[model samples]
Target: MTTGALPTQTLPELPRHDHGGCINKAIQIAETLCNDRGVRLTPIRRKVLELVWESHRAVKAYDLLDRIKPLETSAKPATVYRALDFLIEQGLIHRVESLNAFIGCNCSDHQHELLLLICNRCQEVEERPALEVMNAVAKEIAEAGFHVHRKAIEIHGLCAQCAALELVR
Candidate 1:
């Protein structure tokens, strides 16, 4: 069994930051990973990934489809879903179950447990590699003899910027 390493958590400054870098880095990582895995990152899949990396916010499938239609006129719901499925399979993105939305995975280098911090006010989702928390959870699951297939801990609250804004208000 491969033990996942905890990545350094750097939460973005929500008010101001170079988001273009985020999008570019994500695309580059996706391209490299696809090449390494000998899988095709088709045009549609790449575009879907780009759209998902547009921000740190969670986006709905229908929203992605609507945004993609302008660029990919032939795009349909199935097309978007297929692209989403492929991205998920490749560990390039994550599905935010609570909001029924998707967000780009910053740490796509390896498969690891997810700890998402979602801001209720701004809807931005931050992914944290809580290694200790996950290890504890794993221990408990093992004690219960539960075979875990997938695990993601989604905690919804105010992000730093939103919380600060609330304080001013």
Candidate 2:
């Protein structure tokens, strides 16, 4: 009932578009961008991106490899890792440091900071746009003579649905 809260009723999944379309479009867009930037969107690399975009949940590399099993059959560990590195450099995905996992990004065009809201109980991860908060933090750090080259902001807590369920119990 409160703001930023989901109802107590358990939902199988969050609101999602047609996954087939989502993945396909994401691939097309990423490929287009890579072409524009003169980056190589190799077959293995494209497969990795597809695997990450298969779900909204955080996906570990091992699991990603498993999902893209065909790629694993041909590509070695180094190959997959290198493909992941390329995708990361291109900003096609976001890495969840706490979970040691990767997730496809909704923000594919522009660059911005992300605040991860991870559920301690269910481990559901939500990405909240964190421009203002990160900006403020950066300003404070700058005043303290600190500079940040990279940031993976994670705020762990119960999700709204979990909180509602707890209240009911």
Candidate 3:
């Protein structure tokens, strides 16, 4: 709805719930929504997202394999990898390329290009759909006659709590 209109709410300074409970609710909600949309909530996909969501830090796929059950020969790397792809496609999670891992995105609805602010200390990641830089970049691209499909913006820095700790020292 923000194609041209101002945002309905100021972006949250942080998410709105107990971390543990919020994540659990997000997964359950995603499952039910997927079911209603006639999408398959396969066991492997659920398990993978759960494993990623449990961590405040980005978690590697191999690490997730360890957290979930070890795979049998019948299920090769592609099985879990494909599930991760689907999860990302659905906007239920984000991939941190620097870490070569994934993190759960707790958005209740679909959004445009993602902008992530990652805390180095706590490793907590927050996703926002800010269009400031995105719109500028898109305008530049259009001037050059290039089309942009998908974009993800990641800015790594200390969060509020971590910044306060630094000030005390």
Query: Which numbered prediction scores highest in lDDT against the true structure?
Result: 1
lDDT of 3 by residue, 1-169 (tens): 1222112144224444577887788788778778877888787888777878875666778877665655433555678899899988777788886556788877667464778777765566777778787788778888999876767787777778767866887
Q: Relative to the unseen true structure, what is the C-alpha lDDT of residue 65 in candidate 1, on a scale of 0 to 100?
A: 89
| Deviation (Å) of 54 in candidate 1 | 0.8
Sequence-dependent TM-score of model 2: 0.80
RMSD of each: 8.2, 5.4, 9.6
Candidate with more favorable, higher TM-score: 1 or 3: 1
- Candidate 2 regions exceeding 4 Å error are 1-17, 165-169
Candidate 3 runs further than 4 Å off: 1-17, 70-76
**For model 2, how does the per-residue alpha-carbon lDDT over 1-169 read when each residue is reduced to its tens digit?**
3333233244335545698887887898898889899988988898889888876667778877776766568777778888888888888888888778777875665564778887654556777777888788878888999777777688877789777766887
| lDDT on C-alpha atoms for all candidate structures | 0.86, 0.75, 0.72
TM per model?
0.90, 0.80, 0.77
Ranking by lDDT: 1, 2, 3
Please write out the lDDT profile of model 1 over residues 91-141, one tens digit for every residue: 899998888899998686655588999887678889999889988998999
Report the error of model 1 at residue 134, Å.
Answer: 0.7
- Give the clash count for each candidate: 0, 0, 0
